[model samples]
Target: MIPARSGNIISTGSVCSYIGGGETHAYTCSKHAIVGLTKYAAVELGQFRIRVNCLSPYLLATPLANNFARLDHDGLENLANLNSNLKHVTLKAEDVANAALYLESDEGRHVSGHNLLIDGGFSIVYPSTCFSTQNKIENE
Candidate 1:
């Protein structure tokens, strides 16, 4: 398909790819591997105008998502919302789909070799910072 008509590859990862977990070593490692594969694929395929990217979304209220989480639908939604920076809104399948849609669209033509995180800032921020009572150290 690359030679025929420039292509795009959008893969699904997880927030675990960017953040390490306590005991789920195997699952965490697997997701991280996807990132490596996505990057490698992107570099190799770029020459043929084939873009490759991955979408890493947090917990969503789906059977597949719930199975890994071991939580029911409401519990999954609650946990996701509670942890996300955008606490007002819960992550959804539609959100992940939209990200995929954008990545595959011409709008994202130059966005290869990237992991578009749908994690609602969970991986980027530190939990300690939010709860720390220590003195606020200003950057010099």
Candidate 2:
């Protein structure tokens, strides 16, 4: 995307840099690096018309669902429960695609160096697992 906006100033963000972990010295810090890089690029590229921004999506269902299903059934159940809220509507891949469409459309032309969170209200509630402190193993 940056290359496409070659003449424009650009920004990018990891978006979840603010999330921290338990007994981990720098879990949050590592994620936060995206913010710094984003700001740096924004400042450096402002001279150009190119703009930078990030589209951050959270907890979208993926193929890994089956693997999680294979884990202890309780683990899978726990994850399903974790992904819900009072209203409990998990996000779809289409949701994120729509976001990218909006970002790429004329509507987002002026938007730069912004972290667009497409989270289905999940990040605010389950930041730790939502951003993936745990990765599902590839076992069948």
lDDT of 1 by residue, 1-140 (tens): 67675998988888877777512568779999999999999999988889999999876789986886678999888877777787698887899999999999889989999988898887777333221123223321
Residues 46-80 of candidate 2: C-alpha lDDT, one tens digit per residue: 55656666665543345575363455544544564
- Where does candidate 2 have its weakest 10-residue lDDT segment? 131-140
Clash number by candidate, in order: 0, 9
TM-score, model 1 to reference: 0.84
Number of backbone clashes in candidate 2: 9
Question: What is the RMSD, in Å, between candidate 2 and the native fold over all Cα?
Answer: 6.1
Single out the weakest 10-residue window by summed lDDT for candidate 1. Answer: 131-140
Model 1: per-residue Cα lDDT at residue 68: 62
